[model samples]
Target: MTLALFDLDNTLLAGDSDHSWGEFLIHKGIVDAKAYGKANDAFFEDYKNGTLDIVAYQEFALTALIPLDSAQRKQLHNEFMAQVITPMMQPKAVKLIEKHRQQGDTLVIITATNSFVTGPIATALGIDTLLATEPEIIDSMFTGKIVGIPCFQEGKIVKLNEWLSTTGHSLDGAWFYSDSANDLPLLERVANPVAVDPDERLLKHATEQQWPVISLRD
Candidate 1:
């Protein structure tokens, strides 16, 4: 079966759902009070603009939420399942996911967002698999650190390659759908790349590459 990799956040949810989830945690006092809100806005900003440095995310996540021990960060990320997501998912995106499922494509939600916040979202969508950033954890608690690589840009490729090796699936005529230039690496790697309401940079690049662009938003 072919694969269809979908990005979370703006690709499906219409906004930075993970950051919004972080915002919810700030309001809930789930994360460190001092590191809440825009404490790492620079990282989020770079992410949105498709220029994020994964190393910065790792550093910032650790230094920003020092108050919360690993347990606390895990708790916040776990609670984020109910408090931060669900409501943000768009009906259209859900429908698209269902459509892909009905076609028998192996669907995976490949994102740079943390696995904790995105795990439930991927489950809600009935995704076959998920590949995202892994937050640092010790004794089942968040360390406020990134012990592994942040899944973004070229990182998706690396993660996908490893996953394919496990699933015995390769990117042979597979598809990738996303709306951000940050996802350009993913789009380029896939055999059939479709940009849905892509940002300006992605739009231009897709045009140059002759990759098909689909617009769900007017």
Candidate 2:
């Protein structure tokens, strides 16, 4: 069986969901305007430049939910799904997903973004398997901490291997689609690496590596 792994943010959507989710929260006044806003922007810039500290970024991203009740968080996330994330979903992305499904591959979205932000988006795309950073929760309250390794850069390979072990899946002949240089480690490991509107570094690397390059946007 072929494994088809996809990146959630810019690869499948028209925008970066992790950064946009923070902006959406700030716009809705859910997260504070000054502290969270500034940190969010800075983190996004770091991510774009492939210099992001995944652990630190996760702390910043997940902590905003610490003070919120379960019901409130759910409601706000529903709004985020509707207002912020849905419009970013592109037609070409959906079609690509469909094409992969037709190929009978076991589809999984592997993103460095936390599960809270990506779960609903994955459901919307009809993808059942998601490998994302898991936020720690206790008694329905977010602990503002991440469990296990943050699936960024080389960590993605680690996480994917662990998941595959549990499911009896092998990486042989696997495919990965991503748009970021941060995913290079996992991209290189996969048998088929497709760059989807990749960043400059990833674009150059893909060209040098002779990997297929495709665009879901445009």
Candidate 1 clashing pairs? 70-141, 70-142, 70-143, 71-141, 74-142
Q: Which stretches of candidate 2 lie over 4 Å from their true place?
A: none
Estimated TM-score for each candidate: 0.85, 0.97
lDDT of 2 by residue, 1-218 (tens): 79999999999998999999899889998788998889999999999998899899999888889999989988999999889888899999999999989999899999999999999899999999999999999999999999999989898998999999899999899999999999999998989999999999999999999999999986
Ten consecutive residues with minimal summed lDDT in candidate 2? 24-33
The candidate 1 region of ten consecutive residues with least summed lDDT is 58-67
lDDT of 1: 0.76
Report the alpha-carbon TM-score of model 2 versus the true structure.
0.97
Clashes of each: 5, 0
Which residue runs of candidate 1 sit more than 4 Å off their true CA positions?
Answer: 30-35, 62-84, 216-218
Q: Candidate 1 deviates by what RMSD? A: 2.9
Best by TM-score: 2
